[model samples]
Target: MGRELLNFKMFLSVLFAFTVGYAIITYGRLVREEIGRYDRALSERVQVIERVKAKPITVKGLYLTASSAASSRTRQRIIELIKETELNSVIIDIKDYTGNILYDSDLDLVNQLDTERVVMREVKEIINEFHNADIYVVARQTVFQDPALAQAQPEWAITTEGGGLWRDYKGLSWVDPTKPEVWQYNFAVAREASKLGFDEINFDYVRFPSDGNIRTAVYANLEGSKAETMRKFFKTLDESLQRSRVYTSLDLFGMVLESGDFDLNIGQTLAVALDTVDYICPMTYPSHYPTGHLGLANPADHPYIVVSNGLKKSQTAFAKAERTQLRPWVQAFNLGAVYDGPKIRAQITAIEEADRTSGWMLWNASNNYDSRGLLPDEHAAALRSDVTT
Candidate 1:
C-alpha cells in the first residue's frame, strides 16, 4: 500500500511540472507575437507620418497682380493667363509695394487706425475665384521694408547714427528686426493672413536693410549677432505661424546663396534660415548677382549659366551641410531691360538643369506676365485645363 501511494504521488508531481512548462512556452510565444505586431504597427504609423509630410505637389507659379498693372477688369484675363502659361500658383500681393494694406485687416489695431488704404475690395472673392480656378494663392507680406508701418510707428523704425530714421536708396525706412515687438507686429499680420485662408505666407525683405550704410545705422538694443537676430526673428515667425497649418517661405537675397556665410549685416544665414521656414527662396535672380560671378562677365546677360551655377553651388553647400529645402527665386523681371520670352525660358531651363524637381515662380514687378502666351513647347501640353474645379 505504501509503495502504490508513493507511485501515485510521483505521477502527480510529473504531471504538474509538464503543465507549468507548457504554460511558460505558451506565454513566451504570445509575448513574441505581440512584440511583432507592435513593431509592424509602429512602422506603419511612421510611414503614414512620412507620407503626410512628403506628398509632392508642385508649389510653383507666379508673383501676381497686386504688384502689376492688372486691374479688377482684367481678373478674367489674368486667370486665363494663368491657365495659358501652365502656371497654377499665384503669389497675390495682399500687402504691396506701397505701404497699403490690400485687404481690410481685421486686427483691432489696424482697423482702429483705419490702415486699409487702397484695399482690394474683393480680395476674398478673388481668392475664392482663384480657388475655384484651381489656383493656389500665397500672401506676399513685404516684411522689414514696410514704410506704411514704419511711418505710422516710427518707434519701430531702425534708427541712424544721428538718432533719425535711416532711409535706404529707395527712401524706405524699415522696422528694426531685432525688436520682439516688431516681430509680434509682423507675425500678427501673418496670423491674420493665415486666418484669411492663404495657402502660404511668403516673407519678403525678411532681413536687415543692407542697401543703407550698415556702419552708421544703429540697431535697437538687442543682444546677439545680426545673424542670430535674423535667426531669432525667423524662429519667432515660425512659432507665430505654426498654428496656421500652412507652409511658410522666406524671400532671401540672391547673394545669400553665393556668400560663404550668412550676410551678418542683412541677418541671413542659409542654414539657419532653412531651419525655420518650409522653403528658403534665395532670390537667385541673375540680375541680383554681381558681375563676374562664376566667370560670367554679366550675370544678367547669361541667365542660364549664372543661375544654374549659382544654384548648383548652393545645392552642393546645402548637401554638404544639412539643408532640408531650397526653392530658389529665378529672375522674372528685366534687369538690363531685356525682358523677353528667351530670358524667361532661360531662367526656367537653368532651374530644371539643377535637378530640382520643384517648379519656379516668375516675378514681374508689373504683375504683367507677357510670357503667358509663351512657354517652352515642352511645357505647353502639360498645363492643366480644368480651372472651373
Candidate 2:
C-alpha cells in the first residue's frame, strides 16, 4: 500500500509540472503581443502629432507649371516679379494634368508614382527660396484627371459599358470618383505637400471628365449623384487634412457660380463646394465663358463685367456660409479676347467691386505676365521713371 501511494504522488508531480510549463508559454506569447500592440499605437500617435498646420493668408497669386518652376531662370524671374509687384503667393504644380508627380515623396503610396516620374530635384529648396522672398507657396494637385494613376491601377479607372477603361476626348484617362483609393491617393499627396511646408494645397481638375462619352460611361462604385460624390470627396479631404496645417482650395468651372446645384454634370458646384473647402477658386477666365453668358454677346470681351457678375452670383448662392472663401482665377492668357494688362486688372477690379476680398490668381499658361495692371498707378509711374533713368 505505501508503494502504491508513492507511485500516485509521482504522477501528480508530473501533471502539475506539465500544466505549469504550458501556462508559462501561453502567457509569455500574450504578453509579447500586448507589448507589440502598444508600440504600434504609440507610433501612430507620434505620426499624427508630426503634421503641422499651414499658415492662413489672403493670396493674390500666380500659377506656375512644373517646368516653369524647374528652370532656374524662370524661378528667378518669378521671384523678381513677386518682389516687384503686389504678388504675395505662387501656386506650383505638384501633380499636373498628366498625373505626374513633380517632386519625390517619401510616402509609400507616392513611391510608385515617383518611380515613374519626378519633375523637381529641389522642391524644398525652391519653396525656401520663395519663402525667403516672403512669397506664400501653394501646391496644386490635379485630382481626378490622373492618367498615370488610371494606367497603373486599371481597377480604379472609370469603366465603360464594354467593361474597359473609359477615355476622354483628349485620350486622357481618369480615375472614378467613387473609388476610396482615388480619394486616398490625392489626399496622400496633399498630406506630403503639407509636410513640405506648403501654405495651402490647391486641388484642380477635381471634377469628372467633361470630355468623355456621357451615356455609355458607368460609375461602378458611385452610390449617389455626381455632385454628391464630389461634395463627399471635398468633405472627406477636408476632414482628412484636419490634422495638418495647410489650407484646402478647390478649382471649379467659372459657370458653376451661375449653374446653381447642377454641378455641370461633373460633380462640382459652387453651393456644395462652399460648405466643404477652405477656399473656392472659380476659373473665371473670361475666355472660358460661353457666348451669351450673362446676356453678353461674348462674355470674354467684357472681363470686368463677367468676373464681377460671376462673383455676385456666387455671393448670392452662399450668403450664409462663413467657412469657405471665394478666390477667382483671372485671365493672364489671351484665349478669347486681348488679355492685356488692363484686361487682367478688369477681373481684379471686378472682384473688388463685388465686395469679395479673398483675392485672385492669374492663370497664364506660359507664365509671361504683363505687370501693368497689377501695379498701382503710382508704382507703374515710378517703374517707368526708373527705367528711363
Candidate 3:
C-alpha cells in the first residue's frame, strides 16, 4: 500500500511539471506573435509619415508675423485671401529679427538658453491647416541677428571694441557669422523647420551687421574679406541643407542684383547667392530704394519701372544659373508712396513679365494684405494655363 501511494505522488508531480512547461511555452509563442504584430504596425506608421510630400506650386506668398500666424482671426483672414486670390503660399516667421524662436524647440541649446517664446504652440497644426488648403508654407528664419543667442553665448557674439556685446542700429545684438557654432545653430533651426512640414526655409539677415556703429564693432574670428566669408557661409549652408527635403532660399538686398559684384559690405552678391540657393528672394520694395534709382526721382512712384528694371538686371546677372530661380519680395505697404491696387499690380506684372522668375511674395509688416491687386482664383487659373501652354 505504501509503495502504491508513493508512485501516485510521483505521477502527480510529473503531471504538474508538464502542465507548467506547456503553459510557459504557449505564453512565449503568444508574446512573440504580439511583438511581430507591433513591429509591422510601427513600420506601417513610419511609411505613412514618409509618404507625405510637399505640393509643388509657383509660390505667390505673403509674410505673416509670428503673432499673426498664432492668432485665429488673422490666420483665417489670410487663408481666405489665399483661397480667393492668386496667392498659393505663406511665409511664417520661425525666427524673427528679435532672435526669439516663435515656437517651442527641441534643441538643447535653444532650451537651455530659454530663447523660445512659444508664440505658435500649434505650429504643426498650423502648417497642416495651410497644407490642407493647398498652400505652400515657408519658414522665414533670421540668422546672425540673434540677440538671444548673443546674450546666451556672448563669447560667440560680435563684440564692441571695449569688449561689450556689439549692438546694431536698432540695439539688437548679433552672433559672429564666422563662428561655426552659429552656423550649426541656424542649420539646426532649418532642419527643425523642414521636419515640421515647411516646404521651404527662407534665411534672412545672413550677412554681417549692415547697420550700426561700424567702427566700434569688432569681429574676432573673421579670416577673409566679408564677401568671401559670406560665400563660404553660403556654401556651408548649401552643403548642410542639400539632402533636406525642403527647398532653400536667401533674402538678399534688392541692390545686390544691380551691384555688379559689389557686396554692399554686407556680404551679399547676386551671383554667389543665385548659385547657393534654390531661390533668391531680393527685397525689391521700390519704396526702400533711394531717390534717383532707375533714373527716377522717387522709385516708389514708378513701381513698374523699378521692379522691371531690377528684375531685368537680376535675370542678366544669373542667366547662367541652372538651379536657382528669382522669387522677389515686392512692396505691399505704403512707405514712400501710397501703394494701392494699381501700384501693387504693377509689381506683380513686373514679376510675371520676368524671363525666369518663378513667383513673388508681398511684404507688409502689418500682415494686412490688400486683395484688390491679386487676381481672382479663376483668373489666376487661366493665367497659369496660358503660361503653361
Candidate 4:
C-alpha cells in the first residue's frame, strides 16, 4: 500500500511540472510579440515626427517670380543651375508684389475681396519636383505692398490726411499695416503656403510704405510709433502661424542694420524683426546703397566694400539678439556696376567672411542668373556631396 501511494505521488508531480512549463513557453512568445509591436510603433512615430520637423535648409539660392515658376522652360533653366552649382534653393513668389497669390487657394476672403492668384497648372507638383531634387523652396509673400488688395479694400488702405487713398512714388497704393483685416489676409496666404509644403515663408515689404510723401500720409488706426506698429504686426503674425510647420523670415531694408533706434521711418527695425522672426534678411544689395554709403565714393562700385561693411553692421546688431539668423541679399543684376561672376562672388565672399554659417541669396528682377559660376567650385562640390550623401 505504501509503494502504491509513492507511484501516485510521482505521477502528480510530473503532470504539475509539465503544465507549468507549457504556460511559461506560451507567455514568453506573447511577450516577444508585444515587444516587437511596440518597437514598430515607436519607429513609425519617429518618422512622423521627422516629417513634421522644419526641414534642414541652406539658402544659396535665386529668386523666381510667379511667372517664372509657372513656365516649364524657365524652371528647367533654374533647375540646371541647381544641378550644376552650390545653388540648392529658390524663392518663388506665392504672393507677388502686386498682392496677387500665385497659386489657387480656396480662402473665402481671397475670393470675395481679391481674386485668387493661380497661374501654375500643377503648383504642388512643381514644388515636389524641386523638393525631390533636394532643393529647399521658400514662398515669398509680398506683404504690405499689395496693390490688388489695396484697390479691392480701399477702407483698409493708408489714407491721406484728406481721407483719400495714399499712393506711393510708383503710383502704387498701400494697405495700412494696422488693419486687422490686412493681417488676416496675409496670414491666410501663409497658411496656404505651409499646407503646400514650402520649407520657409518669407515676408517681403512687411513695413509701412516707404515711398511717397511721408508728411501728408495719415493713419487713422495707428495708435503707436511706426516701430511699435511693425513690431505688433510681426508678433501677431508669429502667433497666428502657430499651427504651421515651417520657418518664418522678414525682409528688411539694408539700412535697418545700421541703426537700432531707426526703422527707416517705414516701421521696421532690426531689433523688432529679430525678436519676432526666425530669419532676418537685409536687402544688402550693393547697387541699392546710395552714394557715399559706408564712406565709399560709390557703394555699388565697390561691391566687396559695401557688402563687407554692411555685413559687419549686421553682425554687430545680431550679436545682441539671439535666435535669429542673418541672411543678406546679394546683387545679381547689372546695376550701378557690372555684376559679373567675380563681382557676384565678391559679395558672397564678404558674406562668408562675416558669417560662414549664414547663407546668401541673389536677386535679379528679370529672372536671369547670367553669372553661371557665381558659386565657387569647391563650395558647389561640397553642397552637392551634402545632398548626395
Candidate 5:
C-alpha cells in the first residue's frame, strides 16, 4: 500500500508539471502575438505622421491640367520649362471641375462612385520624378463644383425648385456645400493626396454657386447666412486636415481682399481664409476684375497697377494675421490684354512689392509657360539659397 501511494503521488507530480508547462507556453504565445500587433500599429501611426509633415515651400509654380500631366510629351515639356526657368513647383489637378478623380484611389466610396478616370496612371511615379527634380508638387482639388459627385449622389447635391440637380450658367452641376458627407468626401481626397506625397493641397471653388439663377437654386441643409456657413466649413476643413499635417491653401476671388466683410454672397472672405489655411491664394487675375477697378478703364490692361493696388488694400489685414500668407495668381493666359514677357514681369513685380506676400503662381489654362518673365535656373537657385541661408 505504501509503494502504491508513493507511485500515485509521483504520477500526480508529473501531471502537475506537464499542465504548468503547457499553460506557460500558451500564455507566452498569446503575449508575443499581442506585442507584435502593438508594434505594427505603432509603426503604422509613425509612418502616417512622418509622411504628412512636409515643409511648405516658397512656390513659384505653374498649373498643369490632368490631361497635360497625363500626356508624357506635354509633361516632359512642362518639366523642361520648370528646369529652365525659376519655377520650383507645379500644381497638378487631382480633381477638376468635372469631378473626375485623376488617379486610382484606395477609398471604397471613391471606387463605388466610379469617379476614377485614371488619366495619370503613373501618378506616384510622376510625383517621384518631380521630387527627384527638386520640384514641389501641389494637388489642386475642386470642391463644391463637382458635377460627377452631384450626379452620382443626388441627395448630396444642390437642387432646383423643380427637384432636379441645379445647374450653373455653364450647365454644370454642383454638390451642396452644406452637406457634411460632401465635406468628408473632399477631405478623403485631400488625405489621399497627402499620402501620395503632395507638398500642399489647394482647395478651389470652395463656395456656393455664383453664376446660376440664384433664386431657383435651393440648399436644404443650409443653416445660416452664406458667409457664416462658409466660415464653419473653413473651420471644419482646418480641423480635419490638421491630423494629416499637410500644408493647405484656399483659392479665393481676388475681390475678397478689397471686399472686406462682404462675402460676395459666394461665402468666401479674406479674414476667414486667413484664419483657416496655411496660405490664401487670391485669384488676382487682373482680367477678372471689372473695368472700373482701381480707376483703370481696363484693369487687365494694367497688370502692375491692378495687382499692386489690390494687394496693397489687403496689406493691413495680412499684417494682422498671425498665420497664412498671400500668394496671388497672376494671369498668364491672354484675356484683357496679351500677356507677354513684360506683362508677366509686371505682375511678378507687383507681387514682390507687396508686403506680407509670399511668392506668385502663373495661371495659364493651356499650361504653356516659357522662361520669358522667369529668371534663369541658376539665378533662381541662387536666390532660393540666399533666402534659406
Candidate 6:
C-alpha cells in the first residue's frame, strides 16, 4: 500500500511539472508578441513626426521651357536675360500639357515613343548652371492627363461610356485617378524627378480630365469623391517626397479662389491641398476668368485691378490657413489681351500693393518674354535713382 501511494504521488509530481512548463512557454510567446506590437507602433509614430517637419526652401521664379528655346545661343541669351532681369528662379517644363516629356525619361513606356529627338540633353547641366547662379529649379510635371502613358498602359487609362479611352478636346486620354495604381505610377515619376535634384516638384493637372467628356466618363475603380481621391493622391505623393526632402507644390484653378469649391469635379480643394504642400499657385491669370468677376468686365484688360483684387481675396483666404508660401503665377502670355511692360508692372505692383507676402512667376508659352514690359520706365528710373543715391 505504501508503494502504491508513492507511485500516485510521483504521477501528480510529473503532471504538475508539465503544467508549469506549458505555462512558461505560453507566457513567453505572449511577451514576445507584445514587444513586437509596441515596436511597430513606435516606428509608425516616428515616421509621422518626420513628415510634419518636412518643408521646402523659399524662392521667387519665372516659368521657362528649356525646349522652347533649345538653341545654345538662345539658352545663353536667356541666361543673361534672367540675370539681367533679377529673376533668380525658373520653372522649367519637365512635362507639358501634351503627353510629351521634355527630358529623356527612363520610364519603360516613355522610352518606346521614339520621341527622343525633342529632349534637351543638357537638362542636368543647365539645372546645375542655374543652381550655380543661386537660382532655384522647379521641375513641372503634368499628371493624370498623360495621353502618352495612356497609350502605353491602356489598362490604366480612364474610359468613356462607349468603352473607348476618353478624349479631351485636344484628343488626349487621361489616366484614371480613381485607380491607386495610376497614382502610384505618377507618384513614382515625381519621386524620380525629386531624386534628380529638382529643388521643387510642381505637379500640374493633378486633377481629373477637365476638358474631357465629363458626363460619359467612367472611372475604372469609382472609389470616392473627387476631392477625397485628390486628397489621397496628394497625401501619397507628399509622403513619398518626405523621405527625399524635396519641396512639393500644386497649381489650382483660379475658380477655387471664388467659391472655395474643390469638387469643381477636378479634385482640387485649396484648404486640403495647402495643408500637405509647400506652396499653392492659383493660376490667377485674369484672362482665364469670365467677363464679369468682382463686378469687373474683361478682367484681363485691367491687370492691376484683376490681380490686385484676386490677390487680396487669396491673401484673406490663405491668411487663415497654414502655408509656407503664397506665390502667384502672373500672366506673361498674350491670351487675347494687349499686355505690355506697363501692364506687367501693374500686375507686380498689385501683388506688392496688397502687402501680401509671396513671389510672382511669369508664364509665356513661347519661351519669349518681353523684358521691357516687365520693367516699366517708372520702376526702371526708381531702381537707377535708388542705386545712384
Best-to-worst order by TM-score is 3, 5, 2, 4, 1, 6
Total backbone collisions for each predicted model: 1, 3, 0, 0, 0, 1
lDDT tens digits, residues 210-249, model 4? 8799787877688878999888898899998888888888
Model 2 per-residue lDDT tens digits across residues 144-213? 8888888888888887889888889898888888999899988888888988888899999998888868
Ranking by lDDT: 3, 5, 2, 4, 6, 1
Candidate 3 minimal-lDDT segment of 10 residues: 49-58
Error of 6 at 328 (Å): 1.1
lDDT of 5 by residue, 301-322 (tens): 8999888888999987887788
lDDT per residue (tens digit) for residues 1-389 in model 3? 99999999999999999999999999999999999999999999988887244655689999999999998898889998898798999999999988889998998889988888899999999999988988899999999999988998999899998999999878999999889989999999898888888999999999998889978889877887788888899999999987678889999998888898898988889766767888999999998899988678999999999988888887777778988889999899998999999999999999999987889999998988968788888866787789999
TM-score of candidate 4 to 2 decimals: 0.83
Which of 4 and 6 is ahead in TM-score? 4
Which residue runs does candidate 1 get wrong by more than 4 Å?
1-56, 67-70, 320-324, 355-357, 372-389
> What TM-score does prediction 3 earn?
0.90
C-alpha lDDT of residue 331 in model 5: 89
RMSD of 1: 13.1
lDDT of 5 at 286: 86
| TM-scores for the candidates | 0.78, 0.83, 0.90, 0.83, 0.87, 0.77
The lDDT per prediction is 0.73, 0.84, 0.89, 0.83, 0.89, 0.73
TM-score, candidate number 6 = 0.77
Q: Which 10-residue span in candidate 2 carries the lowest summed lDDT?
A: 109-118
lDDT of 6 by residue, 167-210 (tens): 88888888888888777776767776665667888888989877
110 in model 2: Cα distance from truth in Å?
Answer: 2.6
In model 3, the runs with Cα more than 4 Å from the true position are 1-32, 379-389
Model 5 gets an lDDT of 0.89
